[model samples]
Target: MNRELPVFIRSLPLVLAGWVFAPLIPAHATELPLLFSDGAVLQRDQPLPVWGWAKPGSQITVTFDGGTAKTHASSSGEWRVELPVHAAGGPYELSVAERGGETLRVRDVLVGDVWLASGQSNMEFPVAKAQNARAEIARAGDAGIRHFKVPRSWSDKPEPRLAGGYWRAASPGNAGDFSAVGYFFARELRTRDSRVPIGIVDSTWGGSAIEAWMSAGMLGADATVAAEKIRAKGAAAAQAATQTRARIAAWNTAPPSPEAWAAAALEESGWAGISVPAQWETQGYAGMDGVAWYRKSFELSAPETKGELTLGLGQIDDSDRVWVNGQPVGGMDASWNVPRVYRVPAAALRVGRNTIAVQVTDLGAGGGMAGSAEQLYLRAAGGPLRSLAGEWKFRTADVRLSSTQDDINQVDTALYNAMIRPLQPYALRGTIWYQGEANAYPGAAFRYRDLFASMIRGWRADWSAPQLPFLWVQLAGFHSGGDTAGESPWAVLRESQSAALALPATAQALAIDIGESNDIHPRNKQEVGRRLALAARAVAYGESLVHSGPVFRAATFDDTKARITFDLQHSALAVRGGGRAVHGFELSGADGHFHPAQALIDGGAVVVSSEAVVQPQALRYAWNDDPKQADLINRDGLPASPFRAERTRATLPQQTKQETR
Candidate 1:
């Protein structure tokens, strides 16, 4: 591979990723930020920035594409030079040198459309971890797509740059660790225009809150939402969680010892048989909660056990602790969507049959491992790969709800100061967000409408693009997509997400149909990426396209029914899979209790009315955590955005409404 020309980049596998190793600045020397690295793709047709740190009062000079720029370092050692806007074509080098400062060289940088993809786990979900990743990875060689993964850090004050990270090109070796949503987004865009390069910066953290990504200045600017800063999570949850931790800790060391359930030679005659990689509930442990133990025995010859092995345990719901041959190898807590890849030392394995014991703690939903059998396997270092997903013995250890890990990232500006501010003025074409689950439960969702909007404004202001195209994913149907005919916080959060679309150059992608009933983080991220691409095409690229599905606009009521009109690109509203009727419509009269209603598509509107509601006052569509049958889609195959049309407040229930000062 030529060092001067950008080539396809394939990183080490997922089990060996997330550790960033890149260039850093030295004292009294001019150095580039982590964002400026080999294979970096700068936003074209926009004023580009060449910024970095140097000695105070130093004269800094930046040269790029035969253009020259100069600036003086401030008292705080910060300096920057703006590169005049240029066309979208580059395989160029940028050099920075100071009269009395260190010199730096950034190579193989491309000029193109740059998008910042941020949010929680689903957005951070990688292409290799997504569904059909194997096929995608096998053919995932695209030089036009570049990615810069921002390392995670939090601070009280704005940092000049990230600690360590680098720009990597999209290739099979490294593409799996790249954001699935981001990869698909760029892939779709590049397919439309191969000449234009697409650069996606993934600055995401799993389980992060919206408040964590909003600057304090922006949070303070919004008087309505700024007050929510004081609403930090309760200490009781933390205290109780600590106490529970102490108990669990003591129980683990209480002996009989750890071998009572872990020993390779231990008897398993009394344990029930269950398959690995499937939820226990489906295998006769239905609706059961608490800690459960799963043990499996596999034969490994002496040679096979001589070298270290990589254990691919997909994802364990909630938390898990694993042991091999009575030796504690590894475990994780709370962060469920992260695939478990443990490096098993050769010392932990021996000739003949070995026992693998896993204690899965189910805090919510159900216990056991949650993944397909195909994803559970073992690959010996430089050796053959074997499956570990056959019959296993399972026994319930406890049946109590585990303590919840209180969120510290919810601290007002902690995340924003550390994650967003440092990348300020990075010149982004737009942003894509996937969040709100944290703010969706326990009385915080009602305030998300304002907070979410403030976050967008704050990020845009930081980027210096007021009308930046912002696209977000509506919370997918959850809780099994079952009918929950009661007030739901997730539904409110989705509504809050929809509320942000009122902002200029913003769009929402409806995904009520693609969610997993048992899993909050859906693996079908290809659709998510494609939907966001549609939004980018319409809002960012200025294309006349049907990028969105039907959206509920207003409701016109009558004596016996409510003719609910909708807003869409066209008046062609139909079910997603060739069905005539759509579900998830609820109607309410003066009584205010919503009931499932018969929904009929009349032109661009979905006429909804319940037999019980003779005089309808309100109508709602797809207003539940998991609306499994909410299949109303437009001609472009986009699902309708969830909405609620409430004209009167007198009949509205008090439990569903929270008044924030």
Candidate 2:
């Protein structure tokens, strides 16, 4: 046994002695598990459910708010009793008891609004490093804002209750660990309605696909998903088993031969030159996969230093193995999603010329060394270190096998089974989502809107919260170049998102202007949260905020100009930053060809005209991948949603009726 085992054994007699001296402890026929933990905020105006497992036939009594309710445990050891709905007031205690004498008491319980916040990585992203993190963290000291994070687990079947979770107040100490977007949204809600305590049940998983949050029954119910599941199960099992074997083989494989590697290492003067931080695949090594070695030599005047040394290698596509002077130092796996921070020990350094070598492996798209612009330095005991963010020597190893056949679809499928099903029974105020970047590839995103709406409707049906407030984030601008427009799948996906807003109580956050061209996951999550909160206030709380940008209401075309009208609240149309020329408007004629058109905001509407297209059949605004010049903003400063207008399809009968009219 470990050292603590003896101490625990030694304390048993003392514990018994104390128990004997104290008043006799009551014994119960059945023990019951605790329901919501201490400080839990039960939903107001609804019968609060207090449940646990107890012995069969044992009577369980729950007392709260001057009322008592009793229920008997079933033969299966499950027991549930609901406390009568209490008014929205609390700072009280709740007690649950069995006739035989077991009792559980929770103190400081509150009755208020409770909501479940769940999604993939973006929802799971914490507040520590998000945009305006410091200010937000400092402002999260409100006691009314509470959060509970459900521990991650995967289940083949739905669970009645989560394994473990508890409520915690938002404070600087704990706020850093809370979901940034969720926290901000809740903060906004709490600030708007200070009397109502807001409880956020955070259940999210990073890098999880949408399918994982769907139920197995739901998946089986859909023909497309059913076939996809059948294909996915076999592929998933094979991939898991293969990965297991690969990990084992990696552990068992002998270390690379240092002597052979040294012999293979390029001579100092004869090394090939390459730019640092550029993708090797894009830089004349297209289709190349697996480990490619890069080396750079720098001189150090001092023999030894005390401070830390940091190496900045922009970002690597997949995995990388790095070394300093042929000594294995540090590395990273997965992808360039996370920045690499290596701390060099003083002993690892030597005076004069030092060779820094890196072996990069690209498992998939956009692989190789990246992120070279950040701080990469060799710091001394009392001084700053030298920077290493420039050119480096390079060479390719053996060609890598392409594992593109491995199905990435299994992630969503598995997540649906594990995380989403358990929360089906729990009532929620609404759902806020921030995803779709993962499916933004060509031909893959055409059905995303349908899939997204189906998932929303499916969730509403399952949870019985029909017409529940469902808000989502539109894909922000990303990647270099403007080619991701004009038949771009992302544009199509955005259109789909716009179409979803036609559903009841649904809204979309326009985020094109706030996105970074270099990073798909933008750091400006504050705006993301504020926008989501605005939608929730408008749709869920029935607040009169301008929760949406200008949605395309309708348009009438003349010989030379198209007159467009939109729904605006509290203000008229205004360009971003008060610009004179409204941007991102295009006019297309019957030939399906489009050209830039001059646009002007004319009080709650936009007028578009162009000499290039004398008769405009359709007009599109902010319809490209990166519309940096898109100046269509509401007076409230929210950017107008991206959209493309085409004639709606009418059936022959409807067309005949229109002709008759």
Candidate 3:
């Protein structure tokens, strides 16, 4: 063999030597993974991976900014090459090419620190949907900043790659859909180091649980879906169970007219056209139950539809059945939280036009495609990828399926399998999470302690960053003033979130002050973002600034009053309101009846006394669902987290405690 022979020519000797090999690379060769496209930001000061599918065993090379990395494609067609650390700067081009194959050039790739912003509805709350989005949207242009939203995709099993997605640059047009917390965080990071290009990977799901974000290995067999469902508080579980049983019974008794409904030739003139990636509630069909059908049409050229294909519809709420070109392809009976990735055999696809029909049945919560708009797509089985988001026709019957809605939020590791797993192995500077409302279900708060800590541990292990700086937002204030503070589940949940601080290099972005009583998704996400940014400075960037409010470190009590000490450094304790009396304190006697206490600040400590609490044995601060006046601060403008003293007997929710009894 000639020394300068091409990869294919050099491999001829191995083939003649009777070496077993995978199928040869197609004419269309190499490609970057879903997260490695245009405007993607590589983590700075870390090895940058440029990975994708290449010809099996083919030589692949990635070149960027005066550096190059090379590797051979594995038998499975997977190939990866790591470039040396590239500092924070780029409008540079990333070129990935395969020997004797195709080339991919990702334009506007930047070398910068990357952070994963995640959690439930609050984190997913977009800038456009934020309180002051219009003003923010008007000024939302920063080419240096980019966002890669891992379109919501939940799975039962871990996926090697995202079906299809891309990195979107921040702009007036795109920022509206970007996570307000994430966008605001990135924007503030610009203030600290404007020169460092920043990228935010917004991977969040509205109304999702902390468990849904953990991997299967972390959750184990018979996952949280089975375990937590047993501990599910409130009447929703029983109602859903009843409705599900009846729905299944009715379906088994008489299947609906699905054939006619899935027919491609059916006229849908009366059907309403709606966006694919939006929830039905937001799409004007709130509180909808029973069944609905959605259809979208896309084109495929002569050569394009010949090969095997895959359809990525992100994730749907409740249940869904999919059809391609009037032929049934696949479906999930109860996969409310899992992403839909259906494989379409070549025979099912036509050469020119294609129709994708999805029939969804929602028993509860939000409906329709509850996943990301970015993840919906049609891609060649092992080749080029395409986007299948945008418009689709939807129709629903007036009949309600049942009195209960599906508990999709409890799906086991569904979000982790689809969204988090694929992004793994991508370097991360750290993660910022905003969640916990979902875990406030009665007795669920106690369970949150172990699960929350486990999630942080597993995520760190997954990212290969043992000491990764993980920052989270404590549950914000909500509901009426916790007059029944002892029994509020929200209070307990916040305590569990604080318990995770036991882990190192972790901080909580105190949100007890920024929360709204009437709204779970508060409009003051700017403060939330700013507080998180402050934590990044101290915990992640090692800055010498105060990033947290006063945290309850220890409590000492005299026969009459209690003094609470906090972990503080250069910062001093202040009453936050012109030295006014501090609120959100409670004192309990041996009888365990907690009474509102009068609190005042005294040199890094909060002194509290309650006239009603004689011989105070316990103390609590901000111990309520919504402490309207929990205004303790550390002069840093950051608010203190809600806390309950050990001496105080924490009350469980009335209904929950009674039920447990």
TM-score of each: 0.73, 0.71, 0.70
lDDT of 2: 0.65
lDDT digits (tens) for residues 1-661 of candidate 2: 0000010111111110000011122332443332266877777776666777667788888888789999998888678776777767787788888787677788887777777777655676678657878887887788887888765544434455454567888998788777777887888788788888878777765544566566655444654554465445545444544443332232222126532333324464634567766776445554344455678877666834444556666566666777776666788755455566676666666677667777776654456677656545555556555666677776655433222222232344444544455454554677887766555545545556667777888888976778778888887876523253345556656776777786899888878889876555566777887898899888988888898777777777878888787778665788887855798888888886789999987777788989999888877877666677788878788888777665442110111121121
Candidate 3: where is the Cα deviation over 4 Å?
1-28, 222-406, 480-485, 647-661
Off by over 4 Å in 1: 1-25, 221-261, 264-406, 480-484, 647-661
The alpha-carbon deviation from the true structure for residue 218 of candidate 3, after best TM-score superposition, in angstroms, is 1.9
Candidate 3 lDDT over 39-131, as tens digits, reads 889889998766788778999888998798888999988887778987888888988888887778888888888999988878887787577
By TM-score, the best candidate is 1
Q: Write candidate 1's Cα lDDT for 1-661 as tens digits.
A: 0000111122211111111223444577777777888899999889998788888989998999999999999998889889999788889999999895457888888999999998876787778668898999888899889998876555545556675568898998899889888999899999889888999988876667887787778677553343344233324334444443333332322225556777777878867678777876556543344566888887787788888988878678767888889888889865455568888899999888888888876654445787677678988767767888878887765543222222434667655655677677788889989888777774677778889988888787777789999999998877733234556778878878888888999998877889887667777888988888999999999998888888767777777777766677754788877756778888887787898898877777677777888888877777778878688888877888777776553122233444232
The deviation in Å at residue 97 for candidate 3 is 1.6
State how far residue 277 of model 2 sits from its true place (Å): 12
lDDT (Cα, 0-100) at 554 in candidate 3: 82
TM-score of 1: 0.73
CA RMSD of each candidate after superposition? 11.7, 12.0, 17.8
